[model samples]
Target: MNSALTPDAVVAAERWTAHNYHPLPVVISEAEGAWVTDIDGNRYLDCLAGYSALNFGHRHPQLIAAAHAQLDRLTLTSRAFVHDQFAEFCHRLADLTGQDLVLPMNTGAEAVETAIKVARKWGYRVKGVKPGQAKIIVAADNFHGRTTTIVSFSTDPDAHDDYGPYTPGFQIVPYGNLSAIAEAIDQNTVAVLLEPIQGEAGVVVPPAGYLTGVSRLCSENDVLFLADEIQSGLGRTGETFAVDYEGVQPDMHILGKALGGGIVPVSAVAARRDVLGVLQPGQHGSTFGGNPLACAVGIEVIKLLEKGEYQQRSAELGQRLHAGLETLVGQGITALRGRGLWAGVDIDPAVMTGRRASEALMERGILAKDTHGATLRLAPPLVITADEIDYALDQLKAVLG
Candidate 1:
């Protein structure tokens, strides 16, 4: 940055640039592994991990090296013509996902959009649904993306209010209730899309066997099951995908965030050829979807995940973290819910709300964010060490005390 570009300097730029996000007060300057340094030079443990985009941690060396090397070679060649990087990325990502094909996109929202189109196409061709009559089932309180088409199905007032003439053909059902989902499906229903764990819904984990039940219901009913793993995938939840916890696989997987290894905007939809191949050449595409830089970083991300220790680390650390927080349940908390390294602790409203606890944690040098009104989410990077967890827990205890 320039000499004039302090934390305040960057904040000033954002004030005039866009008002879209309500970011935390801390202005991060540099990051490595599971920690970030502020412009003022104070370091804090990053528990949010860019809302799970930094699952491999901030500025991971391998991901960074891949980006640097790819930058030296090539960046964007677009998808209009094939670059050497696109094919390998498609192959590796498809192989990793255990899917027959992969459709690349640049952000999580676009992947959702792509999946929506793919589902509709499959409905038209395979399921034999009439054009313009296909319906998709989404859960209430879902947070897929902010795109107009995606938000039209949202049950949240804040997400849908004033965004009108909304797209139709979406059905809403209660989350985690398999019967609700099963009942909501009709002949027009093409697919059931839901998060394996509602990460943005305060890390709400469904009842046991809900995923397996959902998969079975979808299979028996002949409706496609789409999983939005953008926030909960890539070992963030102690599995390659959160669905792995129950060994439940969806028809289509929407992935983003950490797929770029926190280095670029890389996202995609992974599915069997019969499902994802719904998109013909002229149907849909993005300029930077399978660019070389993103592909390189993504390849490195897979390598890191395949190294096979990070997921195990997250599972073990999550147990320790959950156990530590369980000890705080009667102290001042209402409840706790989550899986792996992702947790949402509900502070007793009588003592504190999520906002207040977030502010307290920030002041104590452990950064986490609040969700809803009373739940604080703690989703540290999967690579965080035991000492880091101990430090963060100490900060939490100090703040809560």
Candidate 2:
């Protein structure tokens, strides 16, 4: 055991914070690239990457420089007044997404909520749906966010159980089933919201043609196809957006996690002008959504994506990662699913629980997260190297053995 594993720090954190999260025993104090240093002076490879928020890795130089430069000038103006960094960030992100409008927010959930609101409004105003009758169809076992309204439609008991009287107007359908989605839509249906790749449901990838089918269904039904790319976008899936893989253009994109370049909390909804333009002044706003600091960091993130180097790295390295994990199938891993640099490996439950496997990996100086029962999710920074992926796999092999 590493002598520096500070039990006292872990105990203190548990005592002080809410029990919403069950974190690993390791306490990271600093990080660089794909590695983190714990308070105990132990170094470990970071496989989670802040749930894809750190896709570019912690404290990336360009993002940090942008944040620092913005800090010296201005931070917040409350959306009451425009900041110099606002238009540029919005313009660049809009261009990058191939969308005409952007609505900035502070988190992924907020962006999702915004999308919902906009979709509903568009339904009432443009689609001629009756007021208070607009419906949006979501997926089963999907993890969008934890807000009350978002959770109301969640199939996950942990997120949905206590948080009701649930919000109405959302219909749940079996994910990756285009037939179910097609059957669910009605005259009142305003949108079909889904994750291109379900992240929290163990990085599940839909069958080929699923995304395109959803797009077609939405188009035929005159319903908005809203892709929540919060976890799978911004180079995490070896592309600007996972829906890009199918050459499908959704009506709206809910983006976050990596848009701030792992430096600040920045999120947004990108859509066509006619769709997002439905939001007039005072209809929606955020104090810190498009603040100078967030815009500064976001602009740099957009610039990085525009270069397309990170997306390229994710595509190439992701192949290496999946190939390596395939070798472990039936060894300890029972199933594997993911795209780009993200993966979900299902360990043989007879051998160990997912939590136990995560703990074992921690002991080996590697960090990963488990979901469901025996499924472990690995989403390393796009900046991680091939050698580092091999090292993490080596650690996994030992842990399973």
Which candidate ranks first by lDDT, i.e. highest? 2
- Residue-level lDDT of model 2, residues 284-345, one tens digit each, is 98889988999999999989999999999999999999999999999999999999999999
lDDT of 2: 0.94
Please give the range of 10 consecutive residues that has the lowest summed lDDT in model 1. Answer: 1-10
Against the true structure, candidate 2 reaches a TM-score of: 0.99
Q: How do all models score by TM-score?
A: 0.96, 0.99
* Runs of candidate 2 exceeding 4 Å displacement: 3-5
Distance from true location, Cα of 282 in model 1, Å: 1.0
lDDT against the true structure, per candidate, is: 0.88, 0.94
**Per-residue alpha-carbon lDDT of candidate 1 for residues 1-401, written as tens digits (9 for 90 to 100):** 12233557667868787776666677778899998887777778899998889999998888899899999999988887788788888888888889999988999999999999999999999999988999999998899998899899988787888988899889999999999988888888899999998987889899999999999988988899999999999998889999998998799999999998888999999998889777788899999998889999999998888877889988999999998889888787778999899999988888888888887887778889988888899999998988889888887777777
